[model samples]
Target: MKLQNATVLVTGANRGIGLALVRALLGAGVQKVYATARDRNSLEAVTALDSARVIPLQVDVTNHDLVSRLSEQAPDVNLLINNAGVLSFGNILEVPVEKIHEQFDVNFYGALNMARAFVPAIEKNGGGAIVNILTLVALASMPGLATYNASKAAAWSMTQSLRASVSDKNIAVYGVFPGAVDTDMLAGVDMAKTSPADIAKAVLHGIETDLEDIFPDPMSTQLYAAWRQDHKAVEKQFAGM
Candidate 1:
């Protein structure tokens, strides 16, 4: 679906790539952007963009009841961007099990809840798009961030299933993978990172063209190419990173 004049709702809109997506959507001629975060106070920057178009909403995607309420609250929503994520760095053997659940709660289950809650609304509005901000790590495991990688991989698989389920509903599902984005999620990582703004722009472009899987950064594109050629080779390469 075209983003122009579309009503879009973005989760985790307080900072990082989510904030950048709100900005990019505005430039794309979107009619409204419901910028949601767990803490609405953190949405000051987003609300400052365009008071009329930027609607700050306080929402925790992990809350199933609250997410279900979105179908009634924002009935006009057509595009849903699942961008909220968490990263607790530790190897699978060393990381606290609760930490793994925490990451999955937001990264995987949260996205699933949002998708379920908004599907009816999106269908009502004549089917639009769902963009899941997954990671390149979804395709491979990084030893230090084993839990995060696992959570994102689950989300990646979920996105694929959602796409298949929604095939006849006219709703387009997009899975975005970017390697090492310059966001708080990668605070301590010392590697070449893509700007959130650039990733956001690329995502919008992908949506415009109805690209099913979007590789929004150079690293992601290269890694995807390698994976396509030899998945195991790329997996081994990332395991060492």
Candidate 2:
């Protein structure tokens, strides 16, 4: 979709990929961007990028009421980017049940909450797109990040369902699967990571090009190519990581 003059709402825009996305949207000449975080004050840096264009709002995506209210407040939004996420390091069997729930709340349900609340508003504005920020591991199980993988995999499935459900409504759903991003979320991981700025730019390009599934970095593109050839092999490869 054309981003120029598009009104967008980005969740978790206070830092990392979310913050980078806000910058990219502005650079793409979007009319307005509602940059949201759990605490509105946390968005100072993001809003500072363009005080006139960036409107900071507080939202806990897990809270259905807050998301519903936010949708009402941002009635002009045509694009919604579900970028809020949380990660925990643990194997499925060894991970605390609460930890799994915590990750799912932010990574899976949070995205769903925003989608449900915003789809109608987007439709009202004559249809647009919903971009769900997922991960490469969602396609293959990684032992160390079992819960994070499961939650995002569920979201991947949801993205497809959402796409089918909204196809005729002029709404598009894009799933972004990026490999290790150099964000605070992966600060401790020792791997070659793509900068968030690059990922943000790529994601905007994917949307403009109408790529339903986006691999925003070299690593993700390479892994996705391998997975399509032999997914089981990819699973085994990730199991050892």
Worst 10 residues of 1 by lDDT: 65-74
Clashing pairs in 1: none
Please identify model 2 stretches exceeding 4 Å from their true place.
Answer: none
Error of 1 at 173 (Å): 0.3
Could you give me the TM-score of model 1 versus the true structure? 0.98
Report the backbone clash tally of model 2.
0
Error of 2 at 181 (Å): 0.3
What C-alpha lDDT values do all the predictions have?
0.93, 0.96
Deviating ranges (above 4 Å) for candidate 1: none
RMSD (Cα, Å) of model 2: 0.5
Top-scoring candidate (lDDT)? 2
How does model 2 score by TM-score?
0.99
